[model samples]
Target: MSRQKMLARALIVFALLGACGTGARLAAAGEFVAEARTIAELKAVFGQVESRTVVPARARIGGTIREIGISEGREVKEGEVIARVVDDKLTFELNAADAKIAALQSQLDNARTEFDRAQQLLARGIASQSRLDQAKTQFDVIVSQVAAAQADKAVIEQRTREGAILAPATGRVLTVPVTLGSVVLAGEEIARIASGQYYLRLSLPERHATEIKEGGTVLIGQRGLSPVASGGSAAARQARIAKVYPEIADGRVIADVEVADIGDYFVNERTLVWIPVGERKVIAIPPAAVTTRHGVDYVRVATPDGPLDVAVVLGETFQDGGGPRLEILTGLRPGDRIVMPDVAP
Candidate 1:
């Protein structure tokens, strides 16, 4: 088929779409009354897929990364160990602490034996009171020394436990900056996780900022750079405005649209989105009432003289609960009756 024939057929199919309820065309009467109805004026804008919260898994102690259990795009749970860091010095220090504790424990044993013997002698009137007191002091000092060594060992053990890098949030890992054998310092990031729910981040023009609010409804267009149809099945997704940032930067207002099932979307991925800036009254008619000829759109009107075809300039098509309705920009007025053509046999 020729391009013109294809175009004509496509327009015919588009014209057959009719809204329901009050906006529905009176097919039996073969006429539709044009009236002004309030509709949301949508502004087409680009939105980026983003996570609500991005948390980074960080190392608590300085060490060389010994192993990494996660990579980019891997899912992780909160407090999950994603990597392990090893500090050879910490192991050595722990060993030294243990050895010191052992030595002090031996000394404590000897001091304890001496204190007991001194106490026994004192009780038998063989040792002076001062001698027993000195032995007791030595034993107590050795015991304290052992306890200090054990405390040092505990500190080392805690540092060793910090070597494991745990994920901060339960979500997909976005980036892993450090690899195996990479030397990292304490408080350094190991991996960045995209956590919580994903949403679309819209940077709309500052002019529409006042019109947007939390809990407002918006439409999602096609993914990527594909041109969005005026309003069609593919662009029928409706989302709620989760938040609107107060600050404006570079004449743009940032807002977040909460969309479920966007978790599979890549972070920073761009998609077209339609935001309702405000409401306006427009004359909408069903597609079945309009006809196209020679690349021009025409609608028949039932005038007092007879039915006459009037050329109409059409705007964006809007999808609502009724159906898809085409907005007539011009060539028609409110209270005008349109003649609906008979269905072809």
Candidate 2:
């Protein structure tokens, strides 16, 4: 054959291969059928981190605070001494009790000597029996007086020991209201502590009160002024609704959520939380299959005629075991096939 004829035959073969490639690419495109999928409808609301129990360490004795050992943000153990209070009057009373006891002891010794002399004198027939009896009574009276004084001193000592204020619970100290040298009365709070496990407190509208139930799950958003889920791991954002209060207040219903490792969170710190209020059937698909053009979203649908681009109203993004999914609010019907963009060659 001539060289020109051979080149023409090669060009024809290349055209035939290109046509076959086009058909193969079209056949390889993936398709997804739209269906009604039941999803939990989540309502986003602010949740405030709070401690389960707030306990106050109070002064047991009225006095001036002599020393303070704790401040705000400090962790404390139960029965730990946090402050010390000392009353000067108590010390003086203790001293007075000791003096009274010493005086009675002296008197008791003198009475014993007198009683011994009286008994000896009576045995010798020099002292009367009535006199000996009177001396013995005086010795017994002095002994009772000494015992009473000693007991009074013991009570004063106990009061002095009570001047030390101890923490009522094991937790972090939230506030220290009293300072060293500050005068405080008995039972006055020296410090306020946040105790027990920390949780999120949510207040929702009364209209959704019936939907909120114990043991339900909620999604935690990133910590910030506006709490929006930021594609975080499922384990980090998952939490359980631990409690729901029966009483509604101020047109709102209250609930508690428990999360693992919220111990470091500040009390009363607000964060975004998504609660499942109800379930509804909706069309959802992966975001990769949808394309955005000029502020509108579009998805390709495989029709009997050919592939067609259909307009879709997009809802919120949610997570499932497969990955992040975009909600289709409109323009998609059940049994309609969707063309996957990534699967195309």
TM-score of each model, in listed order: 0.83, 0.86
**Clash pairs detected, candidate 2:** none
Q: What TM-score quantifies how close candidate 2 is to the native fold?
A: 0.86
Per-residue lDDT over 1-345 for candidate 2, one digit per residue giving the tens place of the 0 to 100 score = 999999999999998887456434543678788877899988878889999899999999999999999988999999999999999999889989989998999999999999999999999999999999999999999999999899999999999999999999999999998778899999999999998789999999999998989998898876764533333323238899999999999999999999887765388988788888899988988888788879989888877876777899998777778887888999999888887765534
Ten-residue segment with the worst summed lDDT in candidate 1? 18-27
User: In order, what is each prediction's RMSD in angstroms?
Assistant: 7.4, 6.4
Tens digit of per-residue lDDT, candidate 1, span 150-215: 998999999999998898879999999987899999999999999878889999888888899999
Off by over 4 Å in 2: 1-27, 229-236, 293-295, 343-345
For all candidates in order, the CA lDDT equals 0.85, 0.86
Candidate achieving the largest lDDT: 2
lDDT of 1: 0.85
